[model samples]
Target: MAKMQRNTVLVVLSFFAIYFIWGSTYLWNKIAVTELPAFMLAGIRFVIAGSLIFIISKILGFSLKITKQQFKNTILAGFLFLTFGNGVVVWALKFVDSGFAALEVSAQPLVVLLMMRVFQGKKIQPMSIVGVILGITGIFLLVGQKEIIAQDGAILGMVLIFVCMLSWSYGSLFVGNADLPKNFFVNTGYQMLTSGISLLIISTLFGEQWISPIDWSIPVITSMLLLIIFGSIVTFTAFNYLLRIVSPEKVATSSYVNPIIAMILGWYFLNEDITAQSAIASVVLLTGVYFINTKKSLTIFSRFSGKRIPKDPVG
Candidate 1:
């Protein structure tokens, strides 16, 4: 009974980390990217974070060894999810508000569903089909706003972000079946290290000017530290933990919460404008996500209200 209680506490804390910390990452990334080049910022952040993860894992007695196949798979996953998927979205932050970018990326479930249909010949459930349609409508409402589209490079940024979404969606499918390091912490560290190196290579190839950390402003430095520690290490660990201890549909509730947190933070801190149309789109998009995951039990609200989730087989 004591062990079960401790596990429940850890589960709740992990859920909080993924729900809140991951949501705040958009604001941190926006702040850091403002003063640093996109690739360099992301590369440095992940490299440091990955190194720290390895150190912590070693201290905790986790093995670092993996098979050759696992190494290759990790590299591929890293490039798809981090180097291109996340890096390009950071670049788009140069042209779009943090809140806007988060809202747009909130359509990821829709993209993943479509990709599964195309690549795996998976049948889309009736409810998920409705989600896809609402998702499409939400995206149209979001990107069609004249005020947003008229911004310089806004169109290009939105296009590239969509591409990044596709990359992330594909990466999710790949990782679902890929042989990776047995230890989730070690697996995540490998992905971060490989992707960080790839991002640095891309940065060098693009000839982006690298600014020294000494010259970075206080806000930028703070943001970078927050991102590396909380955003990458803490929240990602929590995410993996939740995936092990709970239903995936419950873990995925972060998708619904993150954008709302981001939008509020962006508005409060950066004074980002929240248009009426964008609010409507957020509702529509998240509603679509709800439908997509309705086939599975989602207990976000109950959990938030201090209700215990039914136990699942731990992975």
Candidate 2:
């Protein structure tokens, strides 16, 4: 009973960490990018975070032993997660407001549904397909409320960021399918180190030099460290572990939560304008999450394959 209670507490606390802290990353990117270039900041963040994870894991006696095949898989996963997913998100912060950026990335599960159908041969349910459509519509509506639209570089950046979210979704699915290490720390450390190195190389090729003009004061350093610790290590590592403990639907709830935090932080700190449109769109998006992540609804499509899902309201 005590062990169960302890686990329940841990899971609940982890959800708070991922939903709230990861939610605030958009704002963190906004703050960091004020004077520094986006890619450079991201490259540095990952390298530092990876180093910390690696060092700590070694201290904890975690060994990252992998066969040659797994090494190849790690590289592919790293490309998807680090190169495409995070790389573009950090760049997008250079263009869009963090709140709007968070809302845009919230469309990930819809992308994942389609990707699953394509790659994993997983059948998507009809109602869930409708949910995806509604979620996408909500995203478009949310974007309609955007205060500004940068045409050239900024618009391209937004497109890339959207693609980044898709890549992350696809990468996560692939990682789940792949033969992986049993130890989370070992696997996570390997991923961070390898991927961070790739990011460093990419940033260097793109001339992402560190800014001496940018504030490197104690507070700035502290903020960046918090992002590495809370945003990267805590939220992401906890999130990876959450799948073992809870329903994916419950895990998917963070999609809605991230944007809510982003918007509230915007209002509190950056003072971005928001409206009824955002509220309505956000609610509709979350309802879509409910339909998409519910396991029974997914099983109906998989078990029956072709027959229409029964109009059982319980599902």
Top TM-score prediction, candidate number = 1
Give the runs in model 2 whose Cα sits over 4 Å from its true position. Answer: 1-6, 150-154, 212-219, 297-315
lDDT tens digits, residue span 184-220, model 2 = 6666666667777787787788887676635576545
TM, every model: 0.92, 0.86
Q: Which stretches of candidate 1 lie over 4 Å from their true place?
A: 1-6, 296-315
Give per-residue lDDT, candidate 1, residue 95: 92
What lDDT does model 1 reach?
A: 0.81
Candidate 1, which ten residues in sequence have the lowest lDDT sum? 306-315
Candidate 1 RMSD to the real structure? 5.6
